[model samples]
Target chain A: MTSSNNTDTRLMTGNEACAEAALVAGMRFFAGYPITPSSEIAEVLARKLPSSGGVFIQMEDEIGSIAAIIGASLAGVKAMTATSGPGFSLMQENIGYAAMTEVPVVIVNVQRGGPSTGLPTLPSQSDVMQARWGTHGDHPVIAVVPSTVYETFVWTIKAFNFSEQYRVPVIVLLDEIIAHINEKITIPAHDELAIIDRTLSSQPPESYLPYKNTPSGVPLFAGFGTGYRYHVTGLCHDETGFPSSNARIVEELYLRLNRKIDQHRNDIIEYQTLDLDDAEICIVAYGSSARSAQRAVRIARQDGIKVGLFKPFVLWPFPGEELAELTRKAKTIIVPEMNLGQIAHEVSCATRKDVVSVNRVDGTLITPQEIVKRIYDVQV
Target chain B: MSFRYEIRLSGSGGQGLILAGKILAEAAAIYDNKNATQSQSYGPEARGGSSRSEVIISDEEIDYPKAVNIDFLLCFTQEACDKYCVDIKEKGILLVDSDYVTKVPEGKFTVHKVPITTIAEKQAGKSLVANIVALGIITGLTGIVSKKAVESAVLSRVPKGTEDLNTKAFNLGIDLARELK
Candidate 1:
């Protein structure tokens, strides 16, 4: 891939992978700060966007970064930002604002082990729940986790799609393992890729209700400078985006926001289930750990034990319905993550079955043999 | 009987391990008409860190994106050798760059330490082709890949003028491996 793809695959890191995804997706603006495990995204975009007729700014902090992206998005530009764990926490206020304003922006969080700078170089999937509930209020976030470098290319494109289609924030949850892993992935030309453009409202300024929902429950947002003078605010707003404490309006708007995610469960949920048709035990993992589970299943099968794997590609929508369906066939479910049983809680809640969690807190990957031993230890 | 082998190439950041894996995986999938996938993980700083690439080449479709353990382990540095030596499956070959790496592990499977660096310096006039030389040794030891397929990948991917130099380095590795007993 070293230049044969028309653009040189010139030794790209995971950070570069995200930035390139944004560039090809027609993003015109980028605002991000330098943070460990994710700074490369900023560095690459700083150099690459200008030649493509785009703007890349190194903001003073993560707050400024999120603010800049929202500003750009509101002005009819495709905007993006990248951050790590703590920086993501800092950007939540503006993220909420982007939600309330119905702005389409892409936020990439390349996670490292952290309550705060815990392990910068190591890999961890501890932020699965935080991605869903981090930003303030009841607003939705489309969080996609990519396990391998090849996937970074695919999910980055999905990030742009979810952001545009929903008119809200879309998060790409890439961990340190994949963010730094350098690999060869053949990216097809734009013609071969199916890219979704932002949904724009055609209604005139006077008739526009800023919060009006389509049948799909997502509002087709018109950018600010496009003559749509609809009001927007941080407070709970009515149809025209004016603050309203009215019971009926608030109730309807709140249900529609949540239902937007629920109705598109099939489209939003991405996962791979292997050998569950005849397995006594199953492993539920995401991101880098999913790679380990894949190998463990193959090895376990070779050893005469029927083992299978379930890997969640789209993490935020939770893929709860699929897990519920899978529960009836399997006897036990093993959830392995970089942190101490983060995603396991979700598996237990969704499956309602006794779920076993193989936890690792030190920031290294959970090995395949470890998962296999868990299956044998909890044998039927 | 088909084999499911994940070949991992590990070394410093500039060793072209990722490129080697790409060429090998493409050779398997495109040229050999087998299923193949390549994945990599690196450090923050591009150069002078441990860089590893995983390649899954199979006669059937590949189900997993990650490589658990490797069948062929190529290490160009002591750090990489120390790291990946024990992780390989039993009876798998461990190919180390002898000119750069001197220490060899006493293990069950044959550990071939070829002077890949010296060979590349003599042939290609630089250490850039050391990776190609080691790749040649890899193909010679494991008969899963073909000489024509790898040469095609190298000739196609390398610079226009440097093709002959790299080809010379690759053939030197093929010859050096046969010279190894």
Candidate 2:
């Protein structure tokens, strides 16, 4: 189905749409080891990237995959990688390196059931905490969760935008169900959506401080070959980009790294709520679980249950502020996830309310009827 | 009131049921301008394990992408039919391959038995097009998706050189379903 504006509309899985969106977002380099539920992204990019004058590399492992993207991002190319749980674990060290060095790159993790190589072909949201704190240190992260195939396309582009805008690695966390489910989506025209590019330093080569803390807390980037020489390291560094062990400088470096995202949480956070105006019961969910919650909300509403759904698009900045505010009217708050209350704990901590956690990690999706039953159980 | 029709195509992994499910969803969502979601679940084995592809088509947005209360089911094997017949809605349509599904499970739904793979091999001259033939039977039985839309979706999805074979297989299955109807 084509729209009047001539935008292409066709059926695609979330993974396919994500890869296509990455190309639209101008991702010039993709380095990833093929992993189930996320392999389609690498496969698509391998065939399409070369034709688009981009590079696609199948790395030896996830560590090399993430390292390649970081290196490519340092060279001023839009770069990304995709993996599932096991691969994501191996990439954590570099994820930290990317965070400390302030590299603009996107990582798509299509989470499957896992502690380690757990269920290769099943779905899970167990990686919620991992996506947030997978890498060591007090680093700030922007991770977005897309519940639908359409949102997968939109949020992938947004992940690229947020990564470039804040000069940090952004994670796009999708579960296996969303990655595999096919739906119809209209591809927006290139000029329709806002695409953010990395900010380059216009300062003279001698005066360029790679980590210069600007008013926005984001330092301008100078690509490796851009006639600007600056030290890039994981060591605690100052505005001059040189290693510093100074007490004040170390503290300042950490604060600015966080301040950039913390100060701009309003711009980075995104969420959607439905039938919440008179909702006494609010269901907080994300990724594929949110889709089930949405159906439960509709079913409960039909029964006059006064239920609603709160779905977070940008999962990392966690939408806690909005949840705390919007859920004030909700007498009972429920968090249904594929894991064992990973995000439910966050919801409880965020709202400081007694939240009911409905979890399923047996590889099958939590059904809408199950959520509705949970709502009823709370009602009584 | 929202109108939702759920369909399930279940069989062993190598039966191409997943592709059939995709074509059905594509027909409903793309050619017919309806909202549709198609999802599949299979075991670790690449073939022979139980595999299921579900399609939920609605006039309104489909909040849940799975088929819980299936309106129609196409089972290519007895194992698939036995496992899935319990989930079919009352008065639902259940079509099975007579050659593979010898013993049909008792259900509240109407059961139509056809030699799906045999027809594909004998009529379409290939067993690989059995999935396409099943799609034809699905379209013809329930009228869940329009015939024209299914035709368009099938043509677009099949290999370029073998369009005629697929078309012949699909139409033969459609004609068979019409006779059963």
On lDDT, the candidate that comes out on top is: 2
**Candidate 2 local lDDT, B58-91, one digit each (tens):** 9998888999999999998889988899999999
- Output DockQ, candidate 2: 0.66
Q: Specify the CAPRI tier of model 1.
A: incorrect
Tens digit of per-residue lDDT, candidate 1, span B1-181 = 2678888898888889888887777666655656676776667566888888888787764545556667889998988888788878889888898876788777776788877788788776888888888878887778678888788878767778998888988898788778874
In terms of lDDT, the poorest run of 10 residues in model 2 chain A is A1-10
Model 1 scores a TM of 0.83
A290-374 per-residue lDDT for model 1 (tens digits): 8778877887888788778888889888888797887577888999888888789988989888799998888677888788889
Native-vs-model 1 lDDT? 0.80
Q: Scored by CA lDDT, what does every candidate get?
A: 0.80, 0.92
Give the Å error, residue A235, model 2.
Answer: 1.4
Residues A1-380, candidate 2, lDDT per residue (tens digit)? 22313568889999999999999999999999999989999999999999999999999999999999999999999999999999999999999999999999999999999999999989999998999999999998999999999999999999999999999999999999999998999888789989999889899999988998899999998898878777889999988888999999999999999999999999999899999888888999999999899999988888989999899999898888789999887888999999999988888888888799999989999999999999999988
lDDT of 1 at A29: 96
Model 1 Cα shift for residue B5 (angstroms): 3.0
DockQ of the candidate models in sequence: 0.21, 0.66
Runs in model 1 lying further than 4 Å from the true structure: A2-28, A33-61, A146-155, A176-195, A213-216, A243-256, A263-267, A301-308, B13-19, B30-33, B40-51, B63-69, B88-90, B155-165
Clashing pairs in 1: A180-B42, A181-B41, A181-B42
Model 2 stretches with alpha carbons more than 4 Å out = A1-5
